[model samples]
Target: MGRWEPNARGRLERAALDLYLERGFEQTTVAEIAGRAGLTERTFFRYFADKREVLFWGSAALQEHLVDAVAGAPDCLAPIDVIAGAVEVAGERMQERREGARRRQAVIVANAELRERELIKLANLSAALAGALRERGVDDPAASLAAEAGIAVFKIAFQRWIDDDDRDLTSLIRESFGDLKAVTAGT
Candidate 1:
């Protein structure tokens, strides 16, 4: 019975998404999602602060991994290179869950509220990346620019991953970074 029960977090996310897709985000209630997930409202609260948070379950971990990647990078690498490497490392982490990634992306794309939350999360992540770069002794304008550029690459790579059914996310990210570099060099 315990094994058959859905993972509490995943269940909440799936239930929230189903509700969002069916009734729209503005109309869905946390109690309804908890009930659908076979969890109590309190259990839903334990996992996520609100219904909207269910879609962002992995963001904090992704940010932490990016910070760790930047901190562990070799000292010889340039600031932009360090940020790029961190994004690449994060992409590797994402590669482990292709199906889940696609589903999450679809849920976000289908819901305006989810898309807004995703945008806010991306902005926060870019700030965190900039802070990490600064902690590594990178300077002002360069650190900010590099972090934003890295995030742009991540965005493009993620979209490409959804579009190119045959290609893996990690490879797409690496290619996106290359394309970003080429575009900048050409300008």
Candidate 2:
């Protein structure tokens, strides 16, 4: 089998995940991760500020995709609908790289530290989404609520996608959004 030659940033992320899974997050050293990725510690520093960042390094790009989705959505759509659209768009991006998505999830699942980092990323994503909504003239409580709800839907959908053997992420996101609507409707 051919080994993937990861880009500098991706190499650090993959190395960190591998080390976290094998030896626990607290026990993994930056030097070990750099060695595994066939890079120097200085190269790792150029990509991530610290080891904890490996779990969150891609989040900025993900946030940008989400914001772009919301910004480019048709103006006539409802606020929640716009959020749903953005979530769907983000899901499509993730679906394109199934193996990477699986490995990322697996790494997070295998380590409590990584799981905490994942939660923080989700929270930050929600804040970014809310900020995007506000930029589109959405007001306070509603914007925050919608963004948080959308992120919850995204999380549930993402987990469902990882769990199901047959369903794709886009479909899972759509279904999860519908489910979220149903839950809120009942409240």
Candidate 3:
């Protein structure tokens, strides 16, 4: 609540999400978000480049985590399996923040610009995954194909996760991967 609070970034994010939900993303401003958090506008700028960044600020870190997971996977695994394991680990991390993720998805769904930004973030993530696969000695089209498939698996599982309350994201991710494998195998 204080200007000097230790979790200024967290406080700002909470405040921004609250405002985005209450007033809509286009109607909210950085100053209002900062004020709601009992922080200064400068403090808000320090944590996020703009209000949209409040929703997308974690993209780079998530990408890096996935890349690291892929790179660290066992050499015996195929490219797709490596990606499967990486996305499952990512899903487990996301499963821990279900409520927050649900709310964030709601906000993104309400805004067209936010939706486009989300797609761009996903594309970047896919590219990063492909790069990681290539580094692991996967060939060009294979790396790209596996990366795109992995993103598709993540996207489908994520939507299912958002829509269903009974299933955990990790299971959804694994199930989606299995479905992909099944389709490719002509099952």
In Å, residue 145's CA in model 3 sits off its true spot by 0.7
Q: Candidate 1: global Cα-lDDT? A: 0.87
lDDT tens digits by residue: candidate 3, 23-139: 999999999999999989988887899999999988988998999999999999999999999999899889988888988999999999999999999999999999999999999
Best by TM-score: 3
In order, the Cα lDDT scores of the candidates are 0.87, 0.86, 0.93
The TM-score-based order of candidates, best leading, equals 3, 1, 2
Residue 92 lDDT in model 1? 88
Query: Which whole-number lDDT from 0 to 100 does residue 155 have in model 2?
Result: 90
lDDT of 3: 0.93
Worst 10 residues of 1 by lDDT: 1-10
In model 1, what lDDT does residue 88 have? 91
| Per-model TM-score on C-alpha atoms | 0.89, 0.87, 0.95
Best by lDDT: 3
Quote model 1's TM-score: 0.89
